[model samples]
Target: MTLDDILNTHLGRRALLKSSLAGGGAALAGTLFGGWIPNVAWGADATAKYETPVVETASGKLRGVIQQGVHTFRGVPYGASTAGSNRFMAPRKPEPWTGVRDAFQNGPTAPQLGGPPNPLILGHRAPTFESEDCLVLNVFTPGVTGKRPVMLWLHGGGFAGGAGSAHSFDGNYLARSGDVVVVSVNHRLNVFGYLYLGGVGSEKYRDSGNAGMLDIVAALQWTHDNIARFGGDPSNVTVFGQSGGGAKVSTLLGMPSTKGLIHKAIIESGSALKGVSRENANKTAERLLAKLNLQANQVDELQKLPMEKLLAVIDNRGQGTAGGGPFVLAPVVDGHNLPRDPWDPTAPEISADVPVIIGSVNTEGTFFMPPDSPQFAPLYSLDEAGLKTQLTQRYGDQADKLIELYQKEAPGANPSKLFFMATAFPGDAIKQAERKFAQAKAPAYMYLFTWETPVEGGRRHSPHTIELPFVFDNPQEQPDEVGNGPDLQPLADRVSGVWTAFARTGSPNTSLTPKWPAYNTDQRATMIINDDWKVVNDPRHEVRLIIESVKGRAAS
Candidate 1:
C-alpha cells in the first residue's frame, strides 16, 4: 500500500483500537516497509504532504510533523504503562523498539475528576481521553541540531487533574519565537500517584505515595538521555510550571536525584513549603484501607481492583474542596524517597546551586472567591462606613490600622480593590522565595503579575494561572483571561522572552523590561509585570507584615 493509504488506514483504525494496539500496528507496518515507509514513492506532489521528520530516541525512532517551520512530536512515551501491577509504583523505562513509531496525537491524560468549564482555569480545550497508562510527553523544536535550550513544562492541576496536551500549553509559539526546544509531560496523578501504601502493603509499594513525582523524575532522565536528538541541550534544561506544576518544581528541588539534572527552576504561583507529613499520610492510608475494606495483608487486592473503585473512593475523600480538611492525594514526606520537607523550615540545599524564579498574580483569591458571597457584596458599592465594617469583621483588631496603611499606600482605592489586594499578596510564593534567598548560593528572582483582565467585569484582576498564556507566548488561546486589548502581544513577548532568557542563562533579564535584580533579604526587589513593567523594592511591606502577624497568631 502507498504511504497515504497506510496513514489513512491507521487513522481510521486508531479510533477503533486501543492506543497500544495502534502503535504496534504502525511499528509492524514500518518494519514491512524496510524501517521507513518512504514518502518519495508517492511522487513529488505527495512527498511534501507525506514527509515526516524522524528522530531516534533511546527507546526507539519517532515520526513527527513539521508545521510553520517547527517540528512537533506528541504522545512520546518516556516510561512503560502504569497499569496493572505497575500501578502505584515508580515509573519504569519503556521497552526499546526497533521500528519507527508515529507520534502524531496527544496521549491520554491522567485519570482525573472533571474540572470546571472555565477556560481561564482549565484551558480552552480539554483532553479527549484519559487512562492509567498516560505517562507521555510532547516536544516542539526548531530542528534536530542538538544546540537549543530545552524548556520542560509541568501543567498545573494541583496533583490531580490536567495534561501536557492542553491547547493553551501548545509550544509552537515559544519554540519558534525563542529558537528553543519546548517539552510538556503527563504522568500519574491523584490516588494513582500519591496513595500511601508503604507500610500497608508489600515492600513494592514503599514508594507508592511518591510514584507520581517519580514519574516526573523518570521523564527528566529520559530527557537527559534523549533530548539531544531533538535539537535540545539536555545539560541546559530548565523546568517551569504553574500552580501544582510549580509545587512539583519545588518538590524536585529537594530531591537529591534531581541534582545536576536541572540547571534552573521557575515556580509560578504554586509555592509549596512542605509535603504531607508522615503522620497525616499514614492517617490517609488508614482511611483508604478502611474504605476499601481490605486488611493490611490484603493490600495486593488494591492492584487487582478496578480503577473505577479506587477513583470512587477518591471522589468520596473530597480531594479538592475549598475547605477540605487535609489534602488526601499529595506527595508525602517519606524519609527514603522524599527525605524532608522541601522548604518548610528552610530551603533545600540540593537545589541551592540551581538558580530560581518565583512569583504569583496580583488577585489570586478572586479566582477562588464565589461571586455570590455576601461579604463581597458591599465591594461593588462600599461607603467609608461599609468599608470599615467589612475590614473590621475580616481583620479584627488590626482593621483600623490596616485601612489607614492601605489608604496611604494606594490612594483612591475602593473597598473591592483593597479586598483583592489584601487577599492576593502571594504570601506562599514570597515566603518560599525568602527562605531560598536567605541561604542559596545562587541568585533568586521574584515577579508579580499585575496586569488585570477585563473578564467578568474586571473581577479577574490578575487571578491565579493568568500569566500562563503570556509565559507560553500563546495569549490568543486565552483571550478572555488576557482581555481583547492591544497591549497583550507586547506583554506576551516581554514575558516569554524573559522566561526563555532565564532558561538560557540563570537570570531573567532581557532588553524588553527594566533590569531585574536578584531578590535579597535586605532589598526584596520584585518585578511587577504589566503593560509598564517596573521594579519595586519591598512593595507593600507593612501589609505583608500584617498578614504574617495574623498567620502567626492563628498558628499559635
Candidate 2:
C-alpha cells in the first residue's frame, strides 16, 4: 500500500476505531502504543471493543472503555455545551450524570475552516463537526497507578479547527512509561467561543467574548476536581500544548482566574503575545452579528443557525491575525478571561510561582503556511526581488542581518527554515516573554529543538511541531511506522522522567542525567535536544540582543 493507505490504516484505527461510541471502544487501534518506534506500521487490527471499562475517580466509581491498549473516554463534558441556548456565554458546569455516560466516541468539535490542512491525514472532509455543544474533553490513561502527573493538553488549530481527539495526541506511551495522565480537551472555538456579546445587552452572553477561554478554565477545574480516580493527581498538573495551546497557556499566565489551577506549563512553538485585544475582539463580534442581522439578545437565532453558515461568516476575512496568520484563533482581553496582552502584562512575573518550560523549534513557521504559498503577495511575489523587498519591509534593513545570523549557524538551513526562524524564534514577544518571567523569579527553563529529521527533506529542522514525536517518543515519518529505532526510546524515558520529577517535586532532577538548573536571567541557560543532548546558554543570544537593541531602528 502507499503512504495514504498506510496513514489511513492508522487514521481508521486511531480515530475511527478507538473512537467508536459504543462508549468509544473501537478507536484505539495503535496510536497510543505507536510512540515506541516513532515510525511503525502498527496497522489496526480490530480486537475487543469494550462498551465500558470501570475507572475509580475521585467523584466515585466510573467506567470507561479500552480501545486497543489505550483506554479512551468520549463526550465527557468538561463544561456545559455552548449550544443553542447558551451561545457565547460564560462556561457553566456540565451536568453530572447518574447512569454510565457512553464515551465510546468523541463529542463535536467547534466549527472552523481547515487550518494548516493535514491533507495526509485529515483529507476526509474539510469541515464536518460543528455545534455549540462542543465543550467536551477526553482522557487517555494507561494502567500505571498512584496519582500520576497529569498532562492536560490543548489542541492547536489556530483556536479554531481542532478537537481533543486528533490523531497526534495519543496518550498510551505517555501514560505507561512516564507514569502520567494525559488529557486532550475540546472547548468552544471560533465564532461560538470568541464572540463578544457582553456589550450587546444580551443577558445570556453577558460574558461572551472569551467564552472559549472560560471553557478551558472549566476543563482545568474538572481536572482539579475529578482527576484523582484514574490513578492521576489533580494537583500535580502540567498544562501543555503546541501553537494555539501555547498561546492559551501564555494568556492564562496573566489571568488571575488561572492562578492555583495549574502548577507548571510547557509552550511549544506558540505564544499569545501576538493575539487579540478587547477592542479588536468586540469589533470582530459586531461584524459577525451584523452579518447575521441579529443582536446578542437573539442568541436563539444565532445558535440555531447551521454550523457551516456560522463559520463561513466568522472566517469571512480568513482565520489568522493580520500581522500573524490564520492558524491562530485567540482570546480577547475581556478583563475577566484575559486581562491584558500576556506579554505586555509580564505573565512571566504573574506566574512566577509556577515552573515553566517553553521553547520554539529552529523553523517553527513552516507547517502552518507552505513555503510555496502565493497568498503572501506584495512580499513573497513571484519574483525573487519582490520577495526580498517584502522581507525587508517586514524585517527592515535588519532583514539581511537576520539572514546572516541564521546562515552563520544554520549553514545548511533551507529557504523555508530561514523564513520560519526569522519569523518565530525571538519572534512575537517571545524574547520579552522570557524576560518577564526571568525577572519574576519564576523557575523557568528554556530550550531549542535543533534536530533536522532525516525524512521530510531535513529542511524543516525541528519545524514547528517536530518536537512532538520526540516528546511523545513517537516518530511519524518513516514508511508504515518503520522507525528510527528504539535507541531514542531512552530519550523519551529520560525527558518524561525529568518532566514528572519536576511536576511532583518542582525540579527536573534526573539521576540518569546531569542536574537541570532553574533558569536565571543572568545566564539564560537552555537545554538543547538533538540526537545527542547538551545544556547551552541561549542559542540565539547574539540575534536576540541585535533585535532588542535595533528593533525600532531596523527596516520597515
Give Cα distance to truth, residue 446, candidate 1, Å. 0.7
lDDT score at residue 280, model 2, on the 0-100 scale? 76
C-alpha lDDT values of all predictions:
0.80, 0.62
Which lDDT tens digits does candidate 1 get at residues 1-556? 3233444565553321222122333232221000123323334454345335688998999877665567778778999888888988899998777887766666667877774466455453347466777888989898877589899999888888778777778788899999899999999999899988886777888899999999999989999999999999989999999989999999999887788899999999988999987788778888788877878888888888887788777674444454234437898898877899999899999888888999999878777664456855546566777777877776778877787887887787777777677766778888887998888688889999888887777765778888988898988767767767678889899999999999999899989999999999789999999989999998989888887888788789
Which stretches in model 2 have alpha-carbon errors above 4 Å?
A: 1-53, 56-61, 67-70, 119-129, 295-300, 317-329, 348-350, 371-391, 412-419, 428-433, 436-441, 476-491, 511-514, 554-556
TM-score of each: 0.89, 0.81
Query: For candidate 2, what is the lDDT?
Result: 0.62
Say what the RMSD of model 1 is: 5.9
Query: Which parts of model 1 are misplaced by more than 4 Å?
Result: 1-52, 122-125, 317-327, 370-394
Question: Using lDDT as the measure, which candidate wins?
Answer: 1
Candidate 2, residues 427-514, lDDT tens digits: the string is 5535644665556666677777776554434433455666666565444432212136655567666666666666667676778566
